[model samples]
Target: MRAAKGAKGFKIIGTDGLPGPAGGIEAVAKGGWAGTFTYPTGAKEAIEMSKKILLDCATSVEPTVTVGTTAITAENAKQLMGK
Candidate 1:
């Protein structure tokens, strides 16, 4: 596995790079957090509304969306994801 520059001890080789004879390793993108959800319906709508709320709030106060590469890291992993 190849590690990304400035990632410290983290190795993010990803799915594209496995040994020639991949030992039963199937790399697939697992569906993760896509924002809040509601039973029956309105999951996407809820997320949109939440974004709007966040945008409105950010107009007055600084706001951060912890998405993409910025969200996942070794330091905050345990705290955000738990044990």
Candidate 2:
């Protein structure tokens, strides 16, 4: 867990919400759009943000493929599954 391993905070570059429930498998809190930033206040803002980001960067073409290239290391893997 980066947070537990002395990471104050981190940035995720080039990310998009996952296609299903598996998206939140590693989240610390529950709410908002899957894999999108959820403000403690609500999910609307996060959903809007996701929509804008998706619209601007990627097209929603059916049969689209998401190349799963996210890297995982021993140091970070635990953080994902939780303590």
Candidate 3:
């Protein structure tokens, strides 16, 4: 993979099959807060692009686990507070 100039951060490498002569390596390195994707020569760019696409779908707030008929909303909060 081509390394960017004066950059430093973590890298995430992914591959479909075995890492041998038959199957090659696919790597992606992302810098801190910059949010960029890179790939090696002749390698399919879809994998790298998919990372950004998938990350775009990510949410800062995690999903809440609800059970039974428990109500968790502004109205519920108000009722629970006896307001």
Candidate 4:
């Protein structure tokens, strides 16, 4: 209700796409936030790298890996919940 409490003209955007009640996606779905982006962990990439190094005997792997993020807005906020 911050928007109704004089914050009207200000768009509420969240950086973390936390799910569930009172989370970022919920806030956006309920019209409390304008938008948000998902914060993903690199666990999948880590597991792949470990297998490559241990099983394939790779000498080296890329030190940095880029993980993609998903944008959450009113249009797709609800669909992302319980996911």
**Which candidate's TM-score is highest?**
4
lDDT of 4 by residue, 1-83 (tens): 55464755778888869998978999899888899999889899999999999999999999989999999999999999878
Against the reference, the lDDT scores of all candidates come to: 0.32, 0.38, 0.31, 0.88
As for lDDT, the candidate ahead, 2 or 4, is 4
Give per-candidate clash totals: 0, 0, 0, 0
**Which residue pairs in model 1 clash with each other?**
none
Instruction: Mark the regions of model 1 whose C-alpha exceeds 4 Å error after superposition.
Output: 1-10, 13-42, 46-70
Give the winner by lDDT: 4
TM-score quality measure for candidate 3: 0.18
TM-score of 2: 0.20
Candidate 3 per-residue lDDT over residues 1-83, each given as its tens digit = 34644455754233322222222211111121222122234334554445545877644333332222222232232232221
lDDT of 2 by residue, 1-83 (tens): 34543543553321332333454323322322123321133355556656766876645433433333433332343355442
True lDDT of residue 76, candidate 4: 98
List candidate 2 segments past 4 Å from native.
1-64, 67-69
lDDT of 1 by residue, 1-83 (tens): 22334345433423222112231112211211111111224456657657766766544432543322223333333333321
Clashes of 4: 0
Among residues 3 or more apart in sequence or in different chains, the pairs in candidate 3 whose N, CA or C atoms overlap within 3 Å are none
